[model samples]
Target: MNIISENKSKKIEIEENKSKILDIKKEIEEKKIKIEDKKKELSKVKDMAKGEKEKMEEYKELKKQFKKIENEIYSTIAPLKREMRKLEKIVTDKKLKKQIQEYIEFPVKTFLNDSDLNVFRESIPNIEKIEKNPRKREKILRLIEYVLDGNLEDKKKEYMAYKEKVDSFVITSREENKEGIIKRKIDNLQSEIIKSEEKIKNLETKNDLLQKEILKSEEDIIEILEKDLDVKVQE
Candidate 1:
């Protein structure tokens, strides 16, 4: 009787549900407000994230150039893999076979690390013994001899040239990015953005269910009051 507003009750059957306050109607409204506020916060965070990424333009460009130079180095050393694969199968020496395998696996790194083609020089005699597929063996041996003769030394020099670019890019990137402070900030913001977006999606999903449940609750209350009490209910 105290909750009655004329003929209407001001309070419902329950003030809360479960361990947490679950005022259904109020919860839906509060979540709607939070969704909007979060959207605005996300927009600002996105803008800040954009600004942080812009600051790393130099580093990004360096990365682009680094990939380009790496591809060039890869292209330069690519043929060695095919030559080594055939020769590795034909060569009998265990040590030389492994050395050939290294070049096949990390062609560019192995080539650059060889130093004046000493790896090829050491393996030359072993490779010379390869005579299984006479034609194929001749071809593979030709490649090893080419490296020993310093004809392929230019490729190593070429790799070193790209290495210089990488070294310079690293030094400049560290100095400009200032130990990656901007990159770290950008990464953190990206992580926050993902979390915030997920939170908004979850809240929206909950709000949708809450809104429907509230409507259904209202319908059930009206039906019960009208059928059981034999009275019209209006609020």
Candidate 2:
């Protein structure tokens, strides 16, 4: 009876172990699927990036599409990570944490999930302590706010600087374009002047020919008159 009871207990323990293993496997598969989905989302973003054009109409449309896909990827990954954290919390398995670390510490798109995840994981031990300590939370929150506000201010300045530089570049380009147009106009005017000079030369030649013909006709009339006079004298 003792032997049978021992065997039954071992079997139950094995079954429990199997169940836990299956659960872990399922979770891992789900994570892999999510990773695959993220890869696909990245691919779509790349495709959208390739679709840009120099024309404002096509470029604006592509820009909008790219922004949409980028936002979707970011939003999906953030929530997926939060979900993963919740799942990790439920599993008591140590290997599960390692897997979570593997996924989170990866060079993914999220700031929270990248190199920072390990830091967050390290802070997991202090989570309960920090929660219990209100002052700690307040301190952390203040620090975060300060950092974020400073970053935003820096970004604003940088953006303004960039905008100014771009505006200057545009103005310079416009000036160059204007100069090019003026140069073309000047060249065209010079060509027109040459054509006009040629036309004037042609008109002068025509005038000289007309004048010579008139002189020749006058001489011929005078000769005819002299011949008539000579014939009368002879008679």
Candidate 3:
């Protein structure tokens, strides 16, 4: 071949090599762009995954807190519920039962404190004792006076007069047995018993109403705990 032909061939070869290099550079630039775009997409996916994980963790913690609240409510209320049940069994009167039901349905937190719980505990047993024994009826009457926010000074004077009259008649009758006088005395005793029974009924009614008021106030407290704090209390 001639020198011109050889030079021309060499130039053609160099041009071909340059074109291949350009193509390689273009492919590398495209791959770099694709890699950058993939990195961006991966970062977004990672961020979304992290957000989802955080939300799940937060939800789990919230559920755990709610469970704890439920447990606390149950623990706080269970003993009071048991005591209420015992009191219910002891009191057979319909009015007393209704009052006890109100107490049972009252809020868990009402009697949680030591002072309140002590009062409730003592009150139940005292009520039961007073109801069972005639001698303790006076104590119950006093409690009712306090509950009703009333002064019973006049009623107490009347009771004292009746008691004195009965005692005087008893002492006189032991010394002289007059049939007519004894009959009249028996009638008076019967009348006094009836009045005493009526007074007891009225006192019991007032006591029931006062207890209901107390239970309702406690019920409001329980409602706040249940609705706001997510505490579950057994009714």
* lDDT agreement with native, every candidate: 0.59, 0.49, 0.50
Q: What is the C-alpha RMSD of each candidate to the true structure, in Å?
A: 12.7, 43.4, 44.3
Ranking by TM-score: 1, 3, 2
In Å, residue 219's CA in model 2 sits off its true spot by: 1.0
Who wins the TM-score comparison? 1
> Measured by TM-score, how close is model 2 to the native structure?
0.31
Residue-wise C-alpha lDDT for candidate 2, range 32-146, written one tens digit per residue: 5655565565555444434322333443554455455445434433433543454456556686566655545441233322433333343345444434467765654453344
Better of 1 and 3 by lDDT: 1
Off by over 4 Å in 2: 1-176
Candidate 1 regions with alpha-carbon error over 4 angstroms: 1-77, 80-97, 116-119, 122-131, 174-235
What residue pairs are clashing in model 3?
none
Taking the tens digit of each residue's C-alpha lDDT, what string does model 1 give over 55-135?
Answer: 456557656665675576566556557656756777677977877788888876777677655456654565545445678
For residues 1-235, write the lDDT of model 3, one tens digit per residue.
5444544555565555555555545555555565556556556555655665565465556555544554554454444454456566766678656655665776333323222233343454456543656656555545443423423333334434544555554565466544444355545545554554555556455555545554554564455545544533432
Model 2 C-alpha RMSD to native = 43.4
Tell me which residue pairs clash in candidate 1: none
> Which has the better TM-score: candidate 2, or candidate 3?
3
Better of 1 and 3 by TM-score: 1
Q: After superposition, how far is residue 159 of candidate 3 from its true place, in Å?
A: 54
